[model samples]
Target chain A: SQTIHQWPATLVQPVGSPLSLECTVEGTSNPNLYWYRQAAGRGLQLLFYSVGIGQISSEVPQNLSASRPQDRQFILSSKKLLLSDSGFYLCAWSVLKGGGYTFGSGTRLTVV
Target chain B: TQLLEQSPQFLSIQEGENLTVYCNSSSVFSSLQWYRQEPGEGPVLLVTVVTGGEVKKLKRLTFQFGDARKDSSLHITAAQPGDTGLYLCAGADTGRRALTFGSGTRLQVQP
Candidate 1:
C-alpha cells in the first residue's frame, strides 16, 4: 500500500528564478528513491537517486541538486532556473534491487 | 553501463492487428523490464523477464528474453486502442543498482 506524492502539479517560473519540487513516500521505509525528467520528444532521463537519507547519487550533471531531508521526503532544487530546465519531473521508489518501481503522479515545470 | 536499443521509435497500427517491438543490448542483464506510459503520467510497470530465454504472457501481450541475456522482445496480439502508449525497455545489471533504459517506442493503435 505504498504511494508517492509529488506537488505543485504544474509550475511556471520566470528565468533565473528559484525552483523546488518535493516528493514524499508513504507506506514504505528505506526504499530506493529516484528522480527523472522527461523532455518533449526525448525519453526520460535519470537526474538523481538515493539509497538512503543524505545519500544522493546524481546521474546527470546540471544546474540542479537533490536532498533527502527525511527518510521519505526528497527535494529537487535549483538556485537559478534556466529555460532548459522545463520538463515533466517524476519520482519513483523501489523496495528491492532490480525490482519494479512505483512512480508518483509527476510535476510539470515550465521555466519562462 | 548497459545500453538498450529499442527499435521502431514510433508505431501506428489498426485495432486487431499484431505487432512486435524489440529491445537489444550489447551487455548482459540480470533482468529486463517493460513499462507503458501515457501522456501526463509516469511510466507503469508492465512486465519483467528474469531468466534467460524466458517467455511470459500477459493476456494478449507476450514478452521474451534472449538466451544470451542481452536482448528482449514484446509482441502484442490483436492489439486494441487501449494498448496505445509509449513503451520503454529497461535493463538491470547485477553489478549496477540503476537501470539503463532505452530511448523508447511510441505505439499508437488506431480505433
Candidate 2:
C-alpha cells in the first residue's frame, strides 16, 4: 500500500520569510505528483504538477515554486512569503492513466 | 481553460433524508471524479465515472455520468451522519494532465 507523508502540519511565518513544504510518497515509483492550495471556504487550486523528476509545470505563477528532486519527492518553496500565500497546502499523487488520486495530510500555513 | 461548477454550495439536512449533488460543465471531459473531504484532512476519492451515461452505486450512494460527458450527479439514499463533509467534483479536460475541480459542495447531515 502507498502512503504519502507531508511535513509541518501547521506553521506560522512572518512576512518575507522563506518557506519550504515537503511531500513524499512511499511504495510508489515515478508517480505523478501535484501541489495544491485550498483557501478557507474555497476549492483546491492546482499550483504545480510534475510528471517526472525535474519536470514541474506551474499552474499559477506567484511567489511559490515547486521542484521534484526525486522520483517520489515534491517540494513547494518560496524565497519570500507573501500574506496572500497563507492557506492549506495539499499534496497528491496518481498513476499514468487512473485519474483518481491519493492525497497527503495537508500543511496549514498562516503568514503574519 | 475548462471549468467545473457545483450546485448547492451548502446544505444542512437531517439524517435519513435524501439529497443530490450536481456537477456541470460546458466543455466535454474524458472522465469525472467525486471526492469527499473531511475537516482537517485531504479529499478522498469516492468514485470515478469514465464512460458517458455510466452509473455506479456504492451502497447508498449512486453516481451518474451524463451522456455527453459534460455533467455528473451524486444521489445519496437515507443519508447518515457520517455522510457529512465537503463534496467536490473534478473533471479531466481533454488532453490535459490536471483535473479542473469545482468550487465544491458542503453537506452537513445532522443526526
Q: Find the candidate with the highest DockQ and give its number.
A: 1
Clashing pairs in 2: none
Stretches of candidate 1 off by over 4 Å are none
Scored by TM-score, the top model is 2
For candidate 1, lDDT tens digit of each residue in B2-106? Answer: 678898899999999999999999999999999999988889999999999999999999999999999999999999999999899988887866777788999
Cα lDDT of model 2 by residue, A1-112, tens digit: 8999998899999999999999999998999999999987567899999999999999998999999989999999999999999999999999964489899989999999
Each prediction's DockQ against the real complex: 0.70, 0.69
Across B43-63, the per-residue lDDT of candidate 2 in tens digits comes to: 999999999999999999999
After best superposition, candidate 2 residue A51: deviation in angstroms? Answer: 0.4
Model 2 TM-score (B-chain only): 0.98
DockQ class, candidate 1: medium
lDDT tens per residue, model 1, A1-106 = 8889999799999999999999999999999999999886446788999999999999999999999989999999999999999999999889988888888888
How well does candidate 1 reproduce the true complex, by DockQ? 0.70
